[model samples]
Structure formats: C-alpha cells, structure tokens
Target: MRKQLLGLAAVAALLTACGDTCDENKMVSGGFDNFPAPSASADGPTPGSAADFQKNVQDTVHFGFDRHDLTAEAKTALENQAEWLKKWGGVNLLIEGHCDERGTVEYNLALGEKRAHAAKHFLMSQGIDTSRLETVSYGKERPIDAGHTEEAHAKNRRDVSVVR
Candidate 1:
C-alpha cells in the first residue's frame, strides 16, 4: 500500500511537470503584430464593352501617360463628350484612372487620383453636373493592352471615362 501511494505521487509529479505549458489565456489574448495587406482590384474593362457601349453612347474618355493635367487634346475630347452628355442627361459618368505597370503602388494610386480629378474637373467645367460623376482608381491592376510594349504602356496609363 505504501509503495502504491508513492508510485501514484511520482506519477502525479511527472504529469504536473509535463502538463501543457501553452497558456490558454495567451490564446484568449490576441498575439499577431502585423496583418497582411489587401490585394489590388481585379475589375477591368467590361468584356465586350466596346461592342456594347457603341450601340448606346458611353461618352467615355481616355488620357495620356504620367500626366493628370488635362491637355488641349484632352479638353477637346471632353468638349465633344460634354455635348453628348448635355443631350443625354440621365447617364452617369464614371472616371476610371489607370497607370502603367512601372511605378510603385502608392505612387500609382496618387497618379490615378490625379487623373480622375483632372477628368472630373473637365466635366464640371463643361457644365456636366458634378453629382453625376464618380471616380475610381485601378492603380496598375487593369491594363487595356497587356503587352510590354511602349505603345501598350502608353495606352495603359490613362483615365478612361465610362458611362454607367
């Protein structure tokens, strides 16, 4: 009986020594220091958009590279677009900003914002109601033409106007 009691005590001691060291309270408390960042937008030009928008006027506009500032050509393009909008007042215009796949994400985001602002300003200047305008930036996510050519890059770095 004495030996059995001693053996039971030793077993209890071993069990206590080898017991789970992981604190349940530690798990109850949050432990991570950093979280993963979000993925970029996957949405691009609608499939068969040109064929669809052609039947009904989209008045969509495009822009040039690294340039958020509206050029003479851009202004002329907006003028034609504004005339069309004035005739068809119900359609809302969405200014989607795009950038070449070269710059950093943050830089491209700011550039995209500037491009959208430039187009929005043009529309506002042309007396298209600002209420009907929306701005979105795809950064370098969506390339109209995916080839790594200069022409492709040039075309990619643009603010396209979509009538949605």
Candidate 2:
C-alpha cells in the first residue's frame, strides 16, 4: 500500500509539472476549432510553421448547405492560400472536407469528397503543384460546432487547409 501511494504521488507530481505545455502542444498540433489562434509576437511561429500559415492566410472556407461548389468568398480565400503556397514552395497541404449533419453518412461522405476536390482543383488552377496537395473527407463526423441551428450547420460545412 505504501509503494502504491508513492507511485501515485510521483504520477501526480509529473502531471502537475506538465501543466499547460501539453495543452499548448495539442492546440498547436490541431486541437478543437475553439482553441485560440496563436498570438503574433516578435518571436511568433516560425515563418514556415503551420501557425504562421494560418496567421498569414485564411485556412478554412465555408460551403453552402449540401453544396460542394466554392463560393466567391471561398474562391478569394483559396486565392490567398495559393499565394501563400506559392511563397512557401516546399510546404504541402491536407485539405479536409466536412459537412453538416443533415445528410445520410454515405451521402455526406461523397459530398465532402467533392468539396475537398473543388478546393484542390482551385489551388491547382492557381498554379500550385498537384503533388503538394492531398484531400480527405470527414463528412459530419468531426464538427467544429455541435449545435443544431442553421448557424452551427453552416459552420460545420467547410474545407480546412492544414499545412503538412
């Protein structure tokens, strides 16, 4: 019993020592959408870091309900992303397609794929290399906003560009 208590105490101490560092690392490595954006300072994220990319260029674009087409706003955001990619020639991206919760799982998955492909094609049209872009569809499986309202559903319908 004494040995077990000592082990528990050590574990507690280690966890205490971990503190906020673990959370920070997780947020930097793509935590929930609510995680605050990294602050820009003199010693901000490195120029080619994911945080830098997110800060310098928009990383997400929203789609209309049940539609995979890019909106004018989405096209503008993708244009900015293309410019950023052009500047960082060596960086690659993972385009994640997501959808609202209204559709059947299979249907949502297919729609999400189309959404991701739309973004990829736009980037390619802007002169970004095809080899540097990959895409995946999460459908409604991973929603940034979990509420059932229209605003929430709108938020869920998106394509996110993650630097890889």
Candidate 3:
C-alpha cells in the first residue's frame, strides 16, 4: 500500500510540475477556476506519499439553498478534515465563503461570509486552532458551475478551505 501511494504521489507531482502550483507541502491545483475555494487538491505535509497526505485533506463542502448550516454530511467531512489537520501542526488555512447566484450581490456576499465563518467555527469546535484559520467571502463572484440552472446554483454555494 505504501509503495502504491508513493507511486501515485510521484504521478501527482509530475502532473503538477507540468503546470500546477507546487507548494512546499503538497501540489495545489494551479490556475484553477475557483482559486479561492478549497482547491481541488491539498497543500500540506506530503508525509512521504502525496496520495496518503491528500487523502487526509478534502475539497471544500457545499451548502444548501439560502442556508449556511453545515449539513450532517458536511459535519462529518469537516471532522475528517480536522483529523487530517491535527496530523500536521504549525499550519494555517483559509476559509472562503461562497454563495449561489441568487439574491442581491451584497446580500449574497454577507451570506457567504456567514457560511465561511460557520465552517471555521466547526473546525474550531473540532479542536483546530483559531489562529490557523481565516475567513473570507467571495459571494457569487466565483462559481464552480456557471449555468443558470439549479444544479449549477447548488454547486456554487460552498465553503472552501485552503492550507497556507
């Protein structure tokens, strides 16, 4: 298992070298569409195998319509992520709040901020240091799926985390 994980990490590193953001910790997806959101990749201690390391970290979790409450599923996801974070100390992360393309821009921005803060609070409750987290809101300015459909709107509502 270790060997296989190492091989995957090697592959990820090679892929990242091709034109991705390579942080000292791990390879972060460079020039990604949603740059502020929890990138689709992890940036953390590589732990001898990138795959093993990234497997511990996860992409950001999405929210529901006009709601900032972290769903039960989201709670589980954050708990898992917190576990991964505890594995690597002396780290900082950014929480980017987001929202769907509904409501006024200003209102959405406030909503997004609340969502991001909520995630940060949850992570804190899980034992992550508050000093390690910062919250920002993008509102509806950034969207992972940009169609005028419910599916796209749903995907846009999210709280993403980035290791710094």
Candidate 4:
C-alpha cells in the first residue's frame, strides 16, 4: 500500500511537471501583421465609418499566377463589394490591379489592367454602376509584399478596391 501511494505521488508529480508551465515559442497569430491595412476612402465618411466599412465589406481579391480570371473566392468577395457599393450609391471606387514581380513592366501593366477589368466586370455584373467604378493598373510597381517567396508573390497578385 505504501509502494502504491508512492507510485501515485510520483505520477502526480510527473503530470504536474508537464503542466501549462512549459515554455514554448509557438506561433500565436495569423500573420496578418505583414499585410498592409485597408486604405480608407477619401471624401467618404470619417475614420469610424471607413473602419466599419473595411471590417464589414470586402475590399480586395486575390488571383492565381499569371491569370486574370476571377476565382469563386474573388466572386464571393466582389459580391460583398457590390452590396457595399449599392449601400453607398454616390461613392466612386478605384480598383487598383497589381501583379507579382515576375513579368516585364509592360506585360505586368497589361496583366494588371486585365485583372482590374476582370474585377470591374464582376462588380458590374453584380449591378454596380459602371460610372461609379474606375480601374488603374499598378502592375508590379506597388507590391503589397516585397519578399521573393511564393506566399509574398501570391499576396502581390491582387486587386485592391479603394473608395473615392
């Protein structure tokens, strides 16, 4: 009986030693810190309202490598954007198309234009007015991520909708 009690004590001590007090350098965040914050609309509501819009509405869409086609994800995001556009009828939107750092300047610019057009078309199809939507190609000139990694490249291939 004494041996049994001593074994239980040893087991309890081992469990206690392996408790929450163990130190670890585990990752605890989603890594959104590397991405830039959504830009606020100019001539629209104040920061409070803009923050609400950014938090509630979709403001960006990502694309595949060397492709301007809208994926289902892009369509979903654009659908949300359309709703926001409908709610704020008078606001103009600037769709800034971007590309990864692989293509030549001219090619990237053209590709970016296609990406912007693709997003614009989707928004228009969802009932957004053509007049309220404008597009500009930033190409690889304004990459959201500067690293040479694939993840960074993926992030760079995107269209950002800035309210005007």
lDDT of 2: 0.93
- Where is model 3 more than 4 Å wrong at Cα? 1-45, 48-55
Q: lDDT (CA) for every model shown?
A: 0.74, 0.93, 0.82, 0.88
- Across 13-40, the per-residue lDDT of candidate 3 in tens digits comes to 8887877464656645577563534323
Q: What TM-score fits each model?
A: 0.62, 0.75, 0.68, 0.70
Q: Write the per-residue lDDT of candidate 1 for residues 23-58, one digit (tens) a residue.
A: 655554455433322321234333334333343443
Better of 2 and 3 by TM-score: 2
Predicted model with the maximum TM-score: 2
In model 2, the clashing pairs are none
Q: Which candidate is the best by lDDT?
A: 2
User: Cα miss at 5, model 1 (Å)?
Assistant: 99
lDDT-based ranking: 2, 4, 3, 1
Off by over 4 Å in 1: 1-64
Candidate 2 lDDT for residue 105 = 97
